[model samples]
Target: MDSPPFESFSRVLSETIGPLFVSAIIGGALQGVIGGQAIYYFKYNKADPLVMKCLVLFVWVLNILHYFLVVDAIFIYTVNGHGDPSSVSRLTWSDIAIVLVSDTGDLAVKSIFSYRVWRLSRQWYLSVAIMTGALVTFSFSLYLTITMIQSPSVMPNAVGTFGALITLAISDIIMSVILAMVFWKRRSVFPTVNRVLRMVILYSLETSLVTR
Candidate 1:
């Protein structure tokens, strides 16, 4: 008639704490990269466009907020309420906030790349396609966030969340491929530029692989 002593704790670790820890580690590393980019931009590209500078600042702020939300959730559920059955029975607001902020950060980064794809390719059709995919991914992510907030347990929203993640991954792959193609096409035109473009392509692929 009674559950095992470790049942609640195991469920909580599997459903929330484990995933949050992994996410926090990866997100923290990414935020570090973004910080490095910010430093480089301010140091070497002082004359860059105002819009570009603003976008960088926006992403920095968004990612920081995301990291904060994730840390807060970990503190609330694992650190403060550790081994508490009531806390493990349902998802919390902090958990939902982490999802929301993480999705928002992803959207912001994808938007920047979408614009870069457009600027480099000078092709309206490709840009439109990438932008459309980004929007759809964002929509699904928003739906997932809403469902998580409404649901008592994460299991109920698993399918929706997985679908959104798949969509987001596909969108990222498509954008990376298109950007690589753009670089490849121009490599022949500018021999001296090929090395830089190759590095860019490799970096794009690297990030995409990490995300997947």
Candidate 2:
């Protein structure tokens, strides 16, 4: 068979996708470090340390995934010297392994966070609803990632990473809204409402714009 178009795509993808993912990794790392520190020091009565730890895990996973996506994109770009599809299609098992590991980490964070919320609220109705919603969103995001990577052909850029990033932004918004309502109802006991409120809002807005 004729050599597939890989070189050209690689060059363009590398130049653009590589830098974008690198930037995302930097941002993710910074957020994880800063947010984790805040959670450690702030002593938010409303936040369970276990739940907060899950949030930190989520952030850490984001950074790890960011690095994985960037490196994979760069490698693929380099391999596809001039858009040759053959080598691109020949992705080693290691590549799939990396993606699988990161995907698992992503799911673990989601599960932990959902369990955390359920444990904290102790409200079956609300907690079940939140967990269900999170699961649905996670499924959609994963489907998007797989479709982008393996269908038709290999994507020149990191489509799965972008989908995950968007999913996170949307998830943050949903979670923030729920937490805000809880805080509003228990304002008397939850003195750190303002801080948690700010973090949720900032996380929603800030992550919404963060590209991967």
Candidate 3:
């Protein structure tokens, strides 16, 4: 018997496709922002360190790869494996790949900010604390990826997933607060510095909203 209308499509939609679509859209926009920043960096910061330039290029490449993987997965489901029961019923390797790539991208971004926090505050202890949280989050993410690969038929452990998310959120919030405080402290030294710091503070808060 033929499957009910959208039975396969709806199953995939609810389980994976829909969320991936939304994420792709948002991630694409953020990737654009990063691209713009990269161009600006090259144009204005010619004297910046090679490591900093390479970091921007690395993030841009990862973001592009992440989006490409998502699109490829969607194509595989809707075109290559269209109406295949097996395809709609369980998570594919592509889905797992998306998760892994996303987690890696997140870690890269967080690590960059952790370094920024250290540079701004010059506080070794605070930098270590932030990186400790990041390391825990990365460990949990790795665990989730392994479990997903091992048991694609089963849902991931909710507690572990949520734990990783919570740790990431807390770490981001701490970093944002530290950055804001550092900017505030420097705001009094020079009027030009105060203006730049205000802009930095605003950007930090705006970026933090994504965590919410």
Clashes found in each candidate (C-alpha, N, C closer than 3 A): 0, 14, 0
Q: TM-score of every model?
A: 0.85, 0.54, 0.83
Candidate order (TM-score): 1, 3, 2
Kindly list the per-residue Cα lDDT of model 3 for residues 1-212, writing each as its tens digit.
Answer: 56675675677566777787787788778877878987897899888678767766777788888888888877777787776656665667777777667777777776677677677778877777767777788888888888888888888877668977888788777777777887787766678878988998989877876855
Error of 1 at 30 (Å): 5.0
Q: Pick the candidate with the highest TM-score.
A: 1
- Give the lDDT ranking, best first: 1, 3, 2
- lDDT score of residue 129 within candidate 2: 54
Per-residue CA lDDT of candidate 2, range 1-212, in tens? 33334455466556665775676567556766756765664555445577566566565655566565656655664554435544445444435444445555555555655665566576666555556555655665566546545653555235555655566556656655555555445444455866676676566455535632
Worst lDDT window (10 residues) for model 1?
151-160
Give the poorly placed runs of model 3, Cα more than 4 Å off.
Answer: 1-15, 189-196
lDDT over C-alpha atoms for residue 172 of model 3? 78
